[model samples]
Target chain A: MLKRYLLSPGPTPVPEKVLLDMAMPMIHHRTSEFSNIFKEVREGLKPIFGTRQDVLILAGSGTAAMEAAVVNTLNEGDKVLVVNAGKFGKRWVEIATTYGLDVITIDIEWGRSVKPDQVESKLIAHPEIKAVLVQASETSTTAYHPIEEIGKIVSLRDETLLIVDGITSVGVYETKMDEWGIDILITGSQKAFMLPPGLALIALSEKAWKFTEKSRIPKFYLNLKKERKSQLENTTSWTPAVSLIIGLKSVLEIMNKEGLPNVYKRHALCAEATRKGLMAMGFELLAKDIPSNSATGIVLPEGFDGGKFVKLMREKAGLTFAGGQDHLKGKILRVSHLGYHDFFDTIIALSSLEIGFSQFGLKVELGAGVKVAEEIFKNHLGV
Target chain B: MLKRYLLSPGPTPVPEKVLLDMAMPMIHHRTSEFSNIFKEVREGLKPIFGTRQDVLILAGSGTAAMEAAVVNTLNEGDKVLVVNAGKFGKRWVEIATTYGLDVITIDIEWGRSVKPDQVESKLIAHPEIKAVLVQASETSTTAYHPIEEIGKIVSLRDETLLIVDGITSVGVYETKMDEWGIDILITGSQKAFMLPPGLALIALSEKAWKFTEKSRIPKFYLNLKKERKSQLENTTSWTPAVSLIIGLKSVLEIMNKEGLPNVYKRHALCAEATRKGLMAMGFELLAKDIPSNSATGIVLPEGFDGGKFVKLMREKAGLTFAGGQDHLKGKILRVSHLGYHDFFDTIIALSSLEIGFSQFGLKVELGAGVKVAEEIFKNHLGV
Candidate 1:
């Protein structure tokens, strides 16, 4: 039987060590041992989030944290600017509007980054805007938004909190929340944490914390203030996903041992290899100039269904690649090299893609993509 | 060093097989393999929940599912009869009120079960009440509400939907969702499922589905309609906690092999043995006559601090027990004999508790509790 591989952008491959760590016998969350582990995880996440403030852990996906950030910080009818460049970017608008916020969307084209000027103009035009929401890396379209520039502008403005969805970027990219003036940074365990999805991690700056104080939008389970108060004593406000927290601690330990710089470099190397390999296989990139290091979106050749291609890769080659979402479906295939993936995984993915495309009646050179990926790996590894 | 044990009501000790199952390599959610596993899980949950309706899974705690049940079935200004028997019961009211629902509380004492007559009277008095919310087993006070009676009453009324929080009781107690006329039965992975606390599982009946048509509450992530649409195809509306789902699948498999009837019997036997042992040790039961088979709530002996006693059991005996929440704090210690626990675990817990209580200056005969627990286990096991 062929070995199955998960190459999806969000639920990336978990490290063997993290899996082993999670396999340990469950510990009581109320006990000191669990508290000690939680303390280490909370402190460990601080440097990774690039913030000194408390990081809130929720037993939900990244979307829950996003909802929490909105409900806890923005009041009903509060004006907010949402930078919509992709599916995830649009989700911010959807959630904000659902919470009865006055949402002003800065509509950037799909597969393109949110320009700093567009964000600045939106903020300038709407002085009543209490918050600006954007995605650091839009997983749906593989677009890396200009978060630092957006954060800087929002930071200079009074009362406008900069909320960033760092789901696909936190561990793979440099998301310096405090340094970049991002008021709220949200990520999940699945993406770059090298763990299976269960926990949503979020860090809020003083500015965002202040916004939470007067926010009237009602919330219960995802209340940031209650979570923060409990987390101060190294405990979750409610029952946490204990096994996932253990997995997170193990992944953070690995990340700490490798160092953030090395982790970022590794992701960049994988992204470079995947892009080079796909380009060598005569594939056109969807997000051309500002592609995300988290995932590489490839436009299928004319007459080839990207969704069918993804299915073929999974069924024939045992490679599970992500198909595009919304409008991008059947047009592009997303190849993720984030989290526990490395050069070898990239080679396998490219090889699988080669087989899939060829089998699907699209002409593609066999081993051409793998060879390019190998060359890139060799260059990076100095072999 | 002695191995640690979890005695918390939720986030119970995960079965080793469940952890191992979750540790398996991640699979893409959209793939056939995942869909197959998800389908099996959904089917398995039906027997456990005793519901024929579709069971939707969400990546959050039990509260998320509770929120989903409310937001999906109740509209703004909807009158909901909330039976506040414990912390979780009050939570239903809190969440409903947060969503702008007019909530009428059937306030029962913390350690007492909600009376069926109280619910019936409230519903009769408030003809506008559209929903009746209560917990099957309130984890906070270890009281099992009379859900069957409440269900029967709610079923008699055409417009009032019965929503039961089966989080701590689903797998531990005998829950017949369809037979008992429970419109919406909600549970969490951590409690009776014997997995981590990330996945919230909810099953809705035709009545609940009809109520959803008129629900006007704003919801995104916890929207049951969206979840049902995706779940019919064995997929989630959003990113799922893949590992937790895998763990849940394994747990359900274990439950299937053991059989749900046998699982419930085992939990009942364990709870009986634990309660008998604590009683033999001269400890008073906090929940009194009507108690949850999920956990045994024991009142600390006079002058004994519940927190310190729990700490001693955890630190010195390497046994972790749950201290009571809120009003019961420092007054009661809860010993959970819920999912994944057995006869031997009960014996160990009783022995540890006896030793811890004696060490903390409580008057207790050495080995007395253990003897009682052993006798009960022996009788149940036919040894």
Candidate 2:
């Protein structure tokens, strides 16, 4: 058997403990044992989301929660402003449009964060916009938008709500959902939760709750009001993914034991080390301005196939990095340091990248990248 | 640690092999190895669904697929007929009504199968009906509807589509999608597939495809057309619950090895033994006519509390059985025979029930229920 490492942004490496937790025997969803676990999980998610609001759990991928946010707040033909910077940002616009919302999008260049000025201009021009949707961190392009600035702009209007896609940013970076006036924050269990992708978590502010009450959109299984009612009693509106919930409960305990500040600091140190290592190897970073701290996207050298490079790393080195999507398919490679990662793992990733580049006919110095990464690790760890 | 057995209809006893398979290292969703496994899974599901059509897999519970079926076929204000017999049947009606569809429900008594006459009468009375939805096996009440007869009636109208919820009945009982002329069939991985819940599988016939082309309902994450387009090349429209997919692939391989007929026979034998055991213990069955082979619903004796009986079974005998839902709560106990159960398992379950009844202060003979179950198993196994 080959040793494999997951370096994707969203479905980052899961902790060994989480896997063992999932292997436990399945429990009945209606049992009191499950309700106790569910109650703890709900209370645990509040601080991570940076809010005092109740967070609802759904048994689906991140997109399911994203859809829940849209359907629960917007009615047919309701005006909304979407900031499109990368694949995920554009996905918000697509989903909103699919639900018959009148979407006005502010297009930013791919691999670049959405400018606060641009978002402000869009919202000012469309005063009828009921909501402003943006991604805190776009995983596809590795761009992190300025949520605080967007939140400031949206808070000026009493009727406007700000929705944030925190799927890839929740556990990696700082997200003050309540303090920043973010009305709806959506995330998933796969990315920074260090678990498999079966659970989605969403927290809604009072403003968003009011919008939900007035929204006339048709929904059933993902109905937010009904789900919230059940959550108040520490239950789900429907039969939940019970095994995944157990896994999530275990991961939540681990997160609480390690405190949020230390977890955030560890991810920041790993991200900085990875970036410094790539720079030492003469690789250019994509999203030079306002790059995401969760994942670092590097541009492949001229005439080097990014897809083939990822394949080589996966097959030969057992390191699975993500290739760029759509237009960036053969142009960039994304290396993630989101969850359950450390200094040693960063060193291994740099060594694997060096070998992969060499195999792809790009000249690279052996152990050069690792040396830079180790220095950063030493400085961060003060060892 | 106490040795426990899961007798719930879903989240049933997962095979040890499937659990071990899911514990393997995670794979990148975009890699060729993962795509190869996904392709094999798609091919494997066709025979299980008994359809030449493609089956779309979503990373959600069974209700998500139920929502997908309704949102993709019926437009707002469209007339639809929902045959309600049990909790799941009523759920379909609720889902339809939530989507702004004009739902005409044929409500049947709980624990009884939906009659073909009611379906025909409703259709004849309402020629404007565009779709008819029903459950093949209501897991809540343990009743199996007359799908073959309903299919015959619905096939007469070229415009109206017949949708069947086969979540708990697909692999446990005979469900020949193409042979029965079922326009749409939906199932989940947790039930008879012997895997944990996360993945929902749905297949569509030509009539359902035509309905989708004109459906005006709002959808994005559960959009079947987009899923079908991506699935043509053996890919998902979005990030899938990859670990569950791996577990499902392994479980399907095991099913193929055992053969579908053998799996069905095993479920039938277990169900028969359970029924005999319950009868010998002098307990009345909730589902009087057309009881499902997937599970047996036993009505408690006079002055008996269903919840307390279930708790006694769980704590003392280390057995977990599903209690009644909604109106049936405290009236019946549901014993599931679906998914990876055997004759020995049936015997153990009966013994546990005998212990539970004795603890509840009911007079019952020791080993009598087990003896009856063993005899039934012997007759079925021809030993």
Candidate 3:
């Protein structure tokens, strides 16, 4: 019997401790017992988001929270600037246009991050734009954008709000939402939170809260204003993802015991080792500049079938890695370093890649990649 | 240590087998393994919903599906008739009004079900009503509506649809959606599904599909048409609650093994035993006419302090029961037999209620309520 491992960008491996904690008998959410847990989990999320504002927990996927961010702060016909860098960036445009917002995009190549100057120039060109939408890390391309720099560019304009989708970045790296002038920040539970999907955490600045007063988007389930009132009282506006919230409390405790700084450092080491090991094996990365610490996208060698490779890895080796989407399909493979992953996981990924390349008729030295990864881990012993 | 028991209607206790199944390591959603499970779960939900139509699984609470039922079928400025019998029934009116629908509600008392004749007359008077929104079992008041009779009336008109919120009744009772001509049916995972409160299941009729083509409500997250296309291919449009869906598969298996009819009989037996036991103890039921088989609502004696009774049962005796909402607050108590429940659970509830009564300074004959419950159980041995 072959054991299975999940190495995808999202739906990463959940810790056994967290899983067993969630497996306990269900409790009523309205009771004071659950209220205490909710209060702690809500407070625990703020430091990771780097915010002082109340973080609203929603009972949907990351996309639902992304939709909430757009509908709750903007009205029909409101002009907005979207940074179209990858799949998730394009999502912001789709959500904005669906709500009747006139969108002006700062388009960039799929693997590269948008320049801060480009956003500033777009704001200058369209002063009527009411918001600048972007991503902290694009999961599709494995690229990390300069959110702090972009936050500065948008902060100069009082009328424009800065909205950042930090789904893959919040707990993986440092994202100071308040200090960086980010008006709104969002993340999902399946990413760095080391849990299953279904819950999304979002926070809004004082400035973003002011926009809701004048916004005219009609909503009920995703209404942030109503949710804030309930959340402040240690409850959710709707029936929350209760089991996930309980799992969240345990994960936060785990993260707290390890210290957030060390958590970020561990992710950094895993990502760096994977990237360095792949480079040593003569493979190129999709994200040439500013690679994200959450996941690493590798450019498959010529004549290699990525679809077949991923399928074989999953079915034969019982290892799950993500293949590319859209145009990058059959050309790239993405392996995640986010959420409950460590150095050994990185070593296993590199060793498998070495074997996969050999099976695909490519020349590869045995243990070449793993040796480099081992050296990196050995150098950073504490991490 | 006090062993806590959850007897609430919504967040009911999940079976240990289902909980353990969910505790297994997480898997990627974009794989054949997950797709196969999803396809099976979707197909499994059809027999329970009693519909041949494709049932869509959403990753939010019950209210999200209620909103989806509205935004997908009817457009802005549409008029709808809502049966406002209890708290959840009032929710339909609130959701419809939030999305610009002109709501005309047939207001009824808290514990009484809406009359089918009244609904027929309302539809006859207002032919412009796009839909008749209602609930199969009102959890707040423990009342069950006559959905089949109302469905027959609504089916006679091709222009109007009948939407039923079966959050507490679908698996607890036999709801033949296709036979009864229900256009849209909705339920949550936490209630009769014996899981947590993250996933909502919805199914739409062929006639309801036609309504979506002409509807013009702006939506993105709760877009049912987009979700239907993806769900047909054994996937979801957004990230689903993977763990809860896995738990649903196990619970459905348990139900299938017992047979759906037997499951319904179990719920009916538990509900009847609860009602009879409370009646034997001289407590009046809130639902005087047609009480739901999901839960039993009891009216406390004069100056009995229902809130204090419920609190003591929870804190002191480790038994959790729901207090009355709205006007019934501090005057009634609700105990559930919705999912993963049996006759013993009813006996425990009755025994505790008897103890709580005496502790709260009301004279209660010990073993009086439990004896009637035991007699009922003995009479229906196979169930």
Q: Pick the candidate with the highest TM-score.
A: 3
How should the candidates be ordered by DockQ, best one leading?
3, 1, 2
The TM-score of candidate 3 is: 0.99
Please give the TM-score of chain B in predicted model 3: 0.98
When summed lDDT is taken over every stretch of 10 residues in candidate 2 chain B, the lowest stretch is B374-383
Tens-digit per-residue lDDT, A1-383, candidate 1: 98788888978888888888889888778777788999999999998899999888899988899999999998889999998889998899999989899998988778888778888888778889899998999998888988888877889976899999999999988778999999999999888998888789999999889888998877788889989999999998778888889888898889989888988988898898899889998988888558999999988766677777778777877788898888888888998978888878888888888887887777799999898878778867745
* TM-score of each predicted structure versus truth: 0.96, 0.98, 0.99
* Model 3: per-residue Cα lDDT over B49-126, one tens digit each: 999999999999999999999999998889999999998988998899888999999999999988899999999899
Q: List the residue pairs that clash in candidate 3.
A: none
Q: Which runs in model 3 stand beyond 4 Å of their true positions?
A: none
| The best candidate in terms of DockQ | 3
lDDT of 3 at B279: 90
**Predicted model with the maximum lDDT:** 3
Can you write out model 1's per-residue Cα lDDT over B253-293, one digit (the tens) per residue?
88889888899999988888888889999888878547899
* Proportion of true inter-chain contacts also present in candidate 2: 0.59
TM-score of the second chain for every model: 0.98, 0.98, 0.98
- List DockQ, one per candidate, in order: 0.73, 0.71, 0.92
Superposed by TM-score, candidate 1 places the C-alpha of residue A91 at a distance from the truth, in angstroms, of: 1.5
* Model 1, docking class: medium
